[model samples]
Target: MSFMPPWFWLLLALLFFSALAGWVLQRGLKKQALSADANDVQRQANRRIQQQHLTDLDQALAEGRLSPAQHAMARDDMLRHVLSDATAAQGNGMRPQVNAASAGPVRVVWIVLCLAALSGWSYAQLGAAQTWWPLPLSQRVQITATTPEQLAEQTRAWQQATQSRPADAQAWLTLARLHAAQNQHALAEQALARVLVLAPEHDLWVERAQMKALSAGGVFAGEPWQWIQQVLTAQPLHLNALVLAGSAAWSEKRHDAARAYWQQALGLVPADSDAAQGLQQALAQATEMPKLAEAQASQVVPVLTPTPSGGDTRPLIQGEVRVTPEVQSQIGAGASLFVYAVAEEGSRRPVAIWRSTPTAWPVRFGLSDSMGMGAPPVLSSLAQVRLVARISKTGSAQKQPDDWQVELEGVKTGVQGVVLNITGR
Candidate 1:
């Protein structure tokens, strides 16, 4: 009933009134017709009686029961009496009664038809006819996930939906977010690329760019940088895009450009807001690094420009990597070694990274601020970090199921003689 159209009540009222009017008019006309029929029957009986009396008078006159003048007068009197009876009967029935009774049904029919037409018109003009129609079966039921298993099933369903409906941008977006939630950044980027092609929304472009950077080990260069630039060209004041552009510049060691981008974003946001505070912190870091390096250089007397081995004499964290005998036997000749550092808490993206293909175990490696994958959160700025060493069979940054790896937590910057082992799978 709540879904009924707004004009439904009016239509009901019209139906009631029309029915009432038709019933009342029909009942009245039926009574008048019955009465008129009764009167007509009575008048017919009287005429039959008068006609029989005239026949009897004529018979008596032929039998010589009266003179000619008497017989003629008797016949004339009988005829006058018959005419008077007919006139009285006509007066009893009203002059227009026949026409009124005949027209009553037509009036009732017209009233009903007109009300019906009006109800139809009102429904067409003021009501939603589609609301009364049944919904499709697909739309009537909704499925919601309440558990991890259900969520995984839902993700699979959306993946299938994207495959079946390749042109459906919404399906692609949902699949991308699901993959991202599961840390499958490479797949997320692939799905988001389709979304950009179909919709090309600005915010989605920024999200896709971020996902691309994540898929590439948090290095916002090449395509990711291009995506950010595209968004900035169209919408310079876009907050996320501006922040991303700054991060890209910072990763490339363009501190001044990073500062410029962050400053422009800061001016567009409120000073007391979280965004402004973050931007201020980034600016402060960018401003202090060069000064700190200058102070250290001044303090160090007779700093050598070159070492005997022609390598950086000072490194943030120097490490030696080793593999267990079981894993050493599995390592192929072309196997690559990857070492990375991440903050002790928060984001898992590596702050710095180093990659090499050493010929033997117990190889020495160094990670410094210059090895940072991105900036403003360099190795020197972190109080504590987790270092990881992995032997990759495919030489990819993304870890594989069978790769041997190990992690050391709570390691501080500038720590030396660290030993990392690839004993864990």
Candidate 2:
């Protein structure tokens, strides 16, 4: 349920109370005016009676029925009575005026107090009182800090919301996107899995496959490959799936397959688009290479190695990844560990990537030009590079919260082997 802002309700209450106070003051003024009018009528009646008495006395004196002393005494008595009645009427009128004036202010004070109490109570019950706090200017700067605290908070909120509304596929999809962006691939995959369960669609499956490939550092095999295959089976010309399939084929050195997939993708994309331009370049490069025999196209390309008799003598860097006992317990079964070399400058793509199981900690690996992801600018071409060893519980090379990682920077190519410790960092 959506809630209104406290200020909105407060303003509404103020308007309502002001209207009510005005109504009370208006009623009081009307009553006071009526009382004053009644007092005036009574004063007029008393003057009339006094005038009649004087006329009666004058008539008696003119007829010689009353003596002069009697007339004077009667007039003086009527004057006293008339004066007393006028004084009483004036007092009655003033009392109502004073009470009406005082009633307005008193009623306003009471109304204000009541409205304030009601506002407080309503806000406490309806608003986010516990979470609400004043955000000072000093605290605003910290919100932009490059740490996982804010992301973690958002993840928790999304998790709670997803749990509360399990049937909300869009919420689950959004949660998946958030987790994926934060490099929480395991949670992200879990959320996507939920979305698939709730609402299975071609685009979602393709997205899942893309995430799978990204988590594996652009390698698509096993389950990730199957995801793309499923989408292609349903819709062969699906743009995203085709692109991912092409990338996977390229990574595996299946140039013919990659070319075919990319050509199909190029057809779907706009001719002037960046993707089309890149695909055109790749296609041109593929056309220059000798065509593979049909039988070779169906088979996986074998990793060629130099024979001991006449092998290429380029140097190779050797390394071992070590995991501390404290962090070893945190590593789950089937978790992937990536040890790779990236160029310090120009195209930070991994020159060579090696994957290992978490249980095989302290495993030895070799980095050479032969292990390069693609042709050109191999490990030997770069004067220096950074060697990174990461333990990915989500199987993603991207860093996630609580992942163990270690890097050795400025390591010269063809140098002595270095040891990297995958301690939590």
Candidate 3:
């Protein structure tokens, strides 16, 4: 066998001795108590039965079924209805019946001690208390842990630590989180309690409440709703939380909520942008689209401003006509330029608001304003469009050509949806 720790071995030795001692003591007690109970029982039997019972009692006494003195005591006690079940004394009824002259407190103390020890040893002859180690206590008395021993240690340490320094509420809260994650529901809740005790402020209360409610053993199934109320109570516009709460004004379909969030995002972005693109989708599905009806109402109204006709009637051979960055509208090179407009939407195909007269140093090499219209281009519908803009580098649309294409290269700058491409040579 493996060697045990010093304490274990000592414990085993102590227990073995204690067990032997207890066995002897208990056997004696059992015998004494049984004897007493038998006496009591016999006395009771005598008192209750008529002379017919005397036969049984006489026979029991003769057969040694009952001790003579025991029988006499039982018989007397039964007749007088008095209890005479005291243990046998050694010398006298009183503590050694000390003489008045010698009855010092010290002597009395000695006599008392002797009587107590005698009583205890005599009592053990009948029955005894269980044995246990005095110095080394039971670790089993400690808290629950991974294993019985481990749990005992953990419990012991926790108790000892708590005795030395009470648990902090923050510490409890963190422990609660860890336990909750582990599905240690009860432990998690206990930790949460500590948290509340330590920090009962509104924020902490709310946090504790959330953990308690959401905790496995916690009221989670019931708490998320209450937690939601708190979150909204503090920050109503919390995007995701509120969204999750359900669009109160609307149904489960988060159209309004989604729209609002998307709009919020869209406002901070540039047009023709990815955000704008997303917003466009949002608008399509928004309930507030009607509220924003004015937005789309005018959106369909085409973005083409009328091409301002210049006084020039010349097929002006202009310098390089460069297109505007985002919108493919052309700005002239010289002091003068022409302009044009295409019908709305598709306008037969991708038509320019207007084309510019040719020149050198076109920032874009190929047919930058590139998209092909069929053989003879047809207007998409009666849509307003940017035909062209013939203008000077001075940012001026001079009134000069009346005969040339008299286009926007010959017109004023206004709203125009120019369809142009730089790489589509």
Ranking 1 against 2 by lDDT, winner: 1
Error of 1 at 37 (Å): 50
Report every candidate's CA lDDT. Answer: 0.74, 0.69, 0.39
Q: Compose the digit string of candidate 1's lDDT tens values, residues 32-137.
A: 8878777767767887888888788888888998778988998899888887877776776633356767788898899789878887887678767445564422
Write down the RMSD of all candidates, one decimal each. 13.7, 13.4, 29.4
Off by over 4 Å in 1: 1-158, 164-171, 177-183, 217-221, 289-320, 343-346, 364-387, 400-402, 407-419
Candidate 2, residue 356: Cα displacement in angstroms equals 4.3
lDDT tens digits by residue: candidate 2, 1-425: 23565466566876787667667866876677677666667667867877888999999999999999999999899888877876776665443343554566667676767776776777768866334443322122122222348767766787898889989877787777667655455566677788889777777787687667666676678888899898899899988788778767767868788789878988998899866776676665455433433323454433221111113245667767788888887889978777778777544457677766645556666676545543234576678898988887877677776667888889888775578887776
Better-scoring candidate (TM-score), 2 or 3: 2
Total clashing residue pairs per candidate?
Answer: 0, 0, 63
Task: Mark the regions of model 3 whose C-alpha exceeds 4 Å error after superposition.
Answer: 1-164, 201-210, 213-221, 235-425
User: With candidate 2 superimposed using the best TM-score fit, by how many Å does residue 253's alpha carbon deviate from the native?
Assistant: 3.9
Model 3 lDDT per residue over 52-153, tens place: 555666788999999998778767755453333222322223222223323333444554455556645654575332232222111112222333365445
Best-fitting candidate, scored by lDDT: 1
